[model samples]
Structure formats: C-alpha cells, structure tokens
Target: MRILNLLKIAFKAIVLNKMRTLLTMLGIIIGVASVIAMLAIGEGSKASIRETISAMGSNMVTVRPGADDRGPARGSGGDVQTLIYKDYEKIKEEVSLINYITPVVNGGGQVINGSNNWPSTIYGVNPDYLNIKVVGLQSGSMFTDAEVQSASKVVLLGQTVVDNVFPDEEPVGKMIRFNNIPFKVIGVLEEKGENTFGQDQDDVVIAPYTTVQKRILAIDYLNQIMASAVSEDDASEVVEQVTEILRSQHKLLDSEDDDFTVRSMEELISTFSSTSEMLTILLVAVASISLLIGGIGIMNIMYVSVKERTKEIGLRMAVGGKGSDILMQFLIEAILISITGGLLGVLLGLTATVFIENFLHWPTSVALYSIIVSFAVCAITGIFFGWYPAKKAAALDPITALRYE
Candidate 1:
C-alpha cells in the first residue's frame, strides 16, 4: 500500500496500453504548444511596436488638426485644416519644454530625375524636422533657414527615393522634379526601411514648409505639427501644454471643444500594447479548447480503465488491499501522464517559436511564466479529471465485484 508501489503498479498498467495512453496525451501536447507559441507572437509584436515608436522618438508629440470628438457641431477629422503658420510661430516662441518643433505638410506625386521616376511624398518642414524625428543625414546637409524663409526649392531625399530616382549616381546635388516643380537636392536622409504600420519611411523628400505650402499644394493651413519633448518623462506635460496653447490660439471657450488633437508616443505605445495583449488572450482562449478536450479525454479513459480493472480491484481488496491505495494509484497514474505530456509540450513550443521567428520571419518572445503556467495547469487538470473515476473505484463493493462474470 506504499505510494511508491502504487506508482509502479499504475505505471505498469499504463505501459501495458501504451498506444491508448499516448493517444490520450495528444490533446494536452497540442494545447500547451499552441498557448506558448501564441503568447510569444503577441509579446513579440508588442515589443516590436514599442521599438518602432521609440525609433521615431520616444518623446515625440504630434499635433494634428481636428478634435477627436467629431460631429456636425465639432471639428471633423483628417481634412480639418485649422493649424496655421501663426500657431506654429507662437508655439516656437512660447513653449520651453520642447527640444525641437516643426510644421508638417505633404503632397504625393511622381518624382522624376532624367529618365527615371518613382512615386513619393514630399514633406514640407523646417530644419528641426529631422531633430524632432530623431533622424540623421547620410550625405550633404539639411536645407538652411534661409532656404525655408525664401521658399527656396531645396530638398532632401530618403534612401528609397534615391535608389529609384537617382539609381546610377549620387543623389546629393542632383536636380529632381516633384509634380513638375524642380527642386535642388541638398541632402539624402539615412535609410529607415519601414515602420510598424508598413509605411515606407524612406520614400520621402523633405523640403521647407514654405516651399511645399506655396509650390505644391498651394495651401495656407498647416497639415500637422510635430515636436520632441526635452525627455520621455516630459512628454505628457508637453502634450498638455501644447493642447492648452492650441485651444487658446483657436480661441475656443470652455464649452466649445478645440479643433486639434495632441498625442504622445508613450500613449501610442500603451494603446498598442493593450491591443496586442487582448489579441493574445483571444488566441490563448482558442488554444485552451484543446486542453479542455484533453481533460475530458482523461476522464473518459479513466472511466473505461476503472470498468476494465474491476475484477483486479476486487482481487486486490480480497487480499486486504485498502481502497485508499487503489485511489492513490489511479490518481498518480493520471498526473504522471499529464506532466509527461506537459514536458514534451514545453520542448515542442520552444522549437515552434524558434522556427516561426527564424524561418517565417515572425516575432516571438517566450516568457518563462508561460511554461510554468502550462505545467501547473496540466497537473491541476489531471487531479480535476481523474477524481471521479478514482473515487468510484474506491467505493466498489468487493463482494459483488468478485461475484461478477
């Protein structure tokens, strides 16, 4: 009646039906592996989004036209061209928390240089735009303030533009036309492949806001304004200051909502992280169905096991074997099966994560907590599902059991 002897007896019985035991473990193995892989992908995607946002400046803040609370009464989205040059000037003069700020405007058109052409966007910005974006140049220099003030047709090209427009030659000092307006290329931005949103960060041309506003779009209102706070910790304060300043500039009363939206990179990061976490939970839930099914399988097989071994149970009881020992033996067998499957599942999950990241080029970050959680769940499942059958076997009457055909 020793626990060790019970374990040996249970294990021997399981080994006698090796194929059935293996089949019963299949659902658990698949479930654990699925949970691990899904969580890894979710965590990795969250991390990637944060990294991408940080690269664009963790302390970056954006001021776009329109209130998010939109209606016929309030300002609309996207096309609400309320941001003006005067507002940009006031912020540059009033705000002390910002390290750099720039007014942004853009127009998309075909970029042509000699016999080659490619579709690209031309961004209208001042010299500080690069600083605000935390980007640097690969060659030459940014357009001077004089160029911006004079609406000089000077431009800076991103790597993607350079590759397509000036493939055979150095992009600096070359002449390119954007929407039929000729621009002197003064610099080439360092390569930035793509952002998390799948937008090509490099297929751009940077020019003075004056040039873009007057020459390409012929618009007076600013499209967007971007700024970098003194540090990441100061981003929220900067956002608050910018919001109040814009509200005052727009001359909106307390009851009247201002026509602008302010956002910080920190807020963006948190929003994305939350979204990824929700998606992870959903995927984990779906994968957990397999575990549920596996638990049911254990219960089903245990019931069959108890029925087949009834005669054995009666014989053991006749030899003075206690029902407690019988219950313990069956319970221990179920747990061993679950834990063994869980270990194999952990190994398979790690392998799957590696394959996904390396071969499929998907992101994957395996948290140690995931493995521990899966293992604990497996053990708990065995106990929960194995209890009823074990209890039934323990409650059987040896007298009637022995008299059975």
Candidate 2:
C-alpha cells in the first residue's frame, strides 16, 4: 500500500473509535502541559531574582567591621567598631579601580513634618553614595560635599518615606525633623520596589554620614562602607585592593585576622543564580517523570488496540495487504494522536502560564526551547510506545487472526 493510503486508513481507524482515541491522547496532553508549565515558572523566577538584584546596584561592594575582643570577651562578627571614617577616605584616595566610596552610619527614627509622622531608617552617607547605589532623584538634588563637611541637616527621602510624610505636599526644601533634629529635605529618591530578599528599597531617608555620627548616633566609628568598582570585570581586583588597604589601616600583622569583611554584588548574584538554576533543574526532572508515565500509557493502549483489531488486520492481509503496510498504519496512527495532543498541550500550557501570572501574580516565562523539547518528547514517545504493538500486529498469522472471535 502507498504511504498516503496507510495514513488514510490509520486516521479512519482512530476516528471510528473517537472516544478511545481521545482518552489515549489525554496522557500525552497532560505530560507535555506539565513540562512546559514547570519550566516556565522556574525560568521566570530566575529572571525575576536577577532583575531585583541588578536594580539594587551595579558592580557594588560593601565593607563592614568584623569581630573584636573587649578585655577577653569576644564580640560577634559585624558588631565590631573597627571600620572607621579613615578607612573610607583611604579606599577613595588609594584604590584606582574603585569608582565611588562612602562611609555609612545607620540609624532609625520618627520623621515628622507637622501633623504627618512616619518611622523610617536614616542612612548616613556621602554624596558618592547616590551614584554607588545607583539611586536617582525623583525631585531636587543630592547634598554637596560642603554640606557633608559641615554636617548640615539636609536629607534625601525615599519614595515610601515621601508618600507617608509628604503625602499632601511637595517634599523638597521642606523641613522634616529626625529624632527631634530639624533636617531640610534635599531630594526624593526614585521608586525602587523591593530587593531579592523582600525588603522595601524605598522606605527610608538618606543624610550626611557626619551628621548621623556626630548629631544622631553620636559615634566615631562607621557602621559600614559602600563602594562601587569601575567596572564589573574589575570588581574582584577592587575587592582585593580594598581588603589590603583596610588591613594596613587597621595595623593588622600578617598572622592577625582582619578586622573587616568585604562583599561584592557580583558574588551575591552568582550565588543566587546558581541556587535558582539548581531549583529549575530539579523541577524539570520532576516534571519529566510524567512524560515517562504518559509513554507507558500509550504503550498499553496500543497493545489493546492491536488485540481488538485482529479481525480487521486479518481481512486486510487476506486482501493483499503486506505486513509492512499494517505496521506503517498502526505507527502512523500513534504518531498522529501524539502530534495532535502535543499541539493542544502547547496551547494549554501557554494559557496556564498566563493565568498563573494574572491570578497568582507569579512570574512565568515560556521559552522556545521548552516548546521544542516538549514536542520532540511527544514524537519520541509515540515511536517508542507504538513500535512494539505494531510489530506484534504485523507478525500475526492471517489464518489464526481470521479464526479469532
């Protein structure tokens, strides 16, 4: 028989038992759909995390004081007072790979403008901090070097703070008291939604580090130092140079442990990306099991199909139909069912992804590779599962099959 005739007969056989054909295709449909949905979710989460971290800053690094000993009592790491203003100055002056550096003094207090009051974190920093952290102004301008030097009571407001304190009026040039000290509002930062760790980025105030140290916190040591490298490729080199400078400034001997810690945004990104990749792989693996089960289901159905159509097979063979023709017909039937189910699965999966994104507000990205892989798996499943039953049907004796009830 010609290939076209075999295909026609195969399709006719499937159409004659529409309900059974539909049930058989269900396994493939569910399998392919599950695979696509799982991969979409995984890929979307990875992309979202990367975007969140990137929004925080570019090629940034943070330096914080390490552990210290107070009269034989050891202090916890990052609680030591070893990071000082001089370390910030030296990093700025000596490190050529560094583009920006600033000393950070952190404090929190109630911000009040007339009857409006909102609690916010106060980040004391220099002018360079705005550039290093990649924060932009929604209005007004950053405090100048002269303002920082004089410990001027000027501040920048994050979007969250602006909304809460200055909801009814413009915030720039307005006076907002922090811890009862009146500070003039210099700027309002652009909105930054949230970081990867789920902390609101735009829920605080920025001020000159000197003011927070001398007037508010009343401390000489810095809580942390923020810096940015000249380029992403130069981040590691900049970190090494900064570490050497801090060790020398603190007068640490070769055998002494350093009294500070340095962390790079690049390193953080890599760590988080690796974790997300692992999770994606795990999800893909779990989803693939369904495909295997679907294949097994196809195999079982094809076997039953061969048994029920024995008399039809015998009649075709008696009418000069070859065994190869019978094999081709059954195989083609299986492929048609799988291919149709696969196409439907693709549509269903895409719809599900959009629904998940809209209703759950969870991100989902459907990649071309995922579709190709799902379709290819469907094709392979059809062939592998259909081959055995097709071979068995072709090997049947026409005499025995014709005598079968």
Top-scoring candidate (TM-score)? 2
Give the lowest summed-lDDT range of ten residues in model 2: 69-78
Deviation in Å, model 1, residue 297 alpha carbon: 1.2
Q: In model 1, how large is the Cα lDDT of residue 96? A: 92
User: What C-alpha lDDT values do all the predictions have?
Assistant: 0.88, 0.89
The residue ranges of model 2 lying beyond 4 angstroms of the native Cα positions read 1-5, 45-60, 68-81, 84-101, 107-121, 131-134, 144-153, 159-167, 176-183, 191-203, 208-221, 228-245, 248-251, 264-286, 314-323, 397-405
lDDT of 2 by residue, 1-405 (tens): 499999999999889989988888888888888889889998898888777776787589889898433346766543578888889889999999888889998888999999999999999999999888888999999999999999999999999999999898999999999999999998999898877678999998999999999999999999999999998778888889999999999999999887788888888878887998898898888778887787788888889999999998999999988999999988998888888888888888888889999999988899899999999999999998999999999999999988889
lDDT of 1 at 232: 83
Task: List the pairs of residues colliding in candidate 2.
Answer: none
TM-score of each candidate structure, all chains considered together: 0.70, 0.76
Per-candidate RMSD, Å:
5.5, 4.6
